[model samples]
Target: MASDPWQGHDAAVLFTVLLTGVPTVVGLAVYLGSRLTRQARRRTTPFRTWRDVSLAAAGAALALYLWGLLHVLFLDGQEQAEECERQRPEGTPALVGRRGDFIPLRLVCEASDGRDYTVVIPGYINPSLTVLLLLALLGGVVSLLLHHKQRTSTRKKG
Candidate 1:
């Protein structure tokens, strides 16, 4: 059996997954719960609307990020290995190894002879994640500001 590349990093990966996954699950639950509970309510308040949109956007961003991570963790190394094997000269014997980076989420194949080839992720993933995160942040801020204004207005009228 092949040894797991992520063996020692299980805890860190699990923590990272949960950090993103929890929000995703929560957002899904909130969406479903609201839908089920408010079947008759066609009109949504600004705060609720913004809050839901923010949660959904955040969830989407996290989910995409998670997908990218999983792709790197599982698929990238194997693919890179194959590419390295194909690139090696017929008579040369060189071992191919993987190196990973988490912060920027990258993997590279290192041949024994000091040559390195980077594993490529899909082009759209990072840019899409960035846009979604920005939308989520904007929505959250608007939601919070609207909620505060509503509360203050109520207090003044009461």
Candidate 2:
């Protein structure tokens, strides 16, 4: 995390991680869940299977997801580094004292493109919790379906 000695606050890393990590796991879980449910049916006709569809979909989703992750992890870091390298001259034109929204550009210099580069920092979203939430939801639905199926099967057995 890079910061000016003067700004006294920073939030670059937090946004970087959440924005990057969330979609990756959510997409994967949805893909696999839909697949497994379809595959496990007792007798499905040819040319249709849930497992096949889910797994196939995962490939495309994963590819697009990786590019997003890379942009967050790599490109954002590069931009933030470049942004921090240029700071405003110290004690010149005190933008803080007389301002709207009040950021010290003197302490934080703008990049060549007139954009402030942001550093990619670690964020809250991780695979474990995302998968857990997915499990809870899908597991509940599947359990209900399975219970219903079992009751039907049992009544037929009787």
Candidate 3:
């Protein structure tokens, strides 16, 4: 067990919002903006199916999601280090590097009150959901590409 400056449940919620909600909103904006640009270029409205609508949205959402996950998993150490620096109680010796080959970036510190603490700071996402989201994104992209090809070939033939 690692000491978290944030409450566990609160951390989970913050991670969800940071990793999912913000990106989803931004993705939606980009998706709609691209659609509008395509429509303007073609001078016509493009057909959209329920599946296409859902899948495209899903793809955008998932792509942004994976980016956020990567940041949390691999690029958030600096933020955590900053947190440890800002939050550690005063006069605690400089945080020592974690031992072992598999340890996450962390600081082992002893407080002035003589209590030992392991400040294991890291961002998190659910692995299972990440896998599922990736698969769905792949499927969505394949389906969309096939759909576009079919439409273009039909337009050429007609």
* Strongest candidate by lDDT: 1
Candidate with the larger TM-score of 1 and 3: 1
**Model 2 C-alpha lDDT versus the unseen true structure:** 0.40
Q: List runs of model 2 lying over 4 Å from the truth.
A: 1-48, 76-158
All candidates' TM-scores?
0.65, 0.26, 0.30
Return the clash pairs for model 3, or none.
none
Best by TM-score: 1
> Residue 85 in model 2: shift from native, Å?
13
**In candidate 2, what are the lDDT values of residues 1-158, reduced to their tens digit?**
23432232233433454465466657656755564664545554222343334333443434443433444444333354443443434433322211001111111334333343222222222343344345455545555666677689889999
Model 3, TM vs. native: 0.30
Q: Across residues 101-125, which tens digit of lDDT does each residue of candidate 1 receive?
A: 5555555556567765545455577
Expressed as tens digits, the lDDT of each residue in 42-157 for candidate 3 is 75323344334555556554555444444434424455455556777766666543211112322334343555454443334234345545655666666677678878999999
Q: How many backbone clashes does candidate 2 have?
A: 2
Off by over 4 Å in 3: 1-20, 23-124
CA lDDT, every prediction? 0.67, 0.40, 0.49
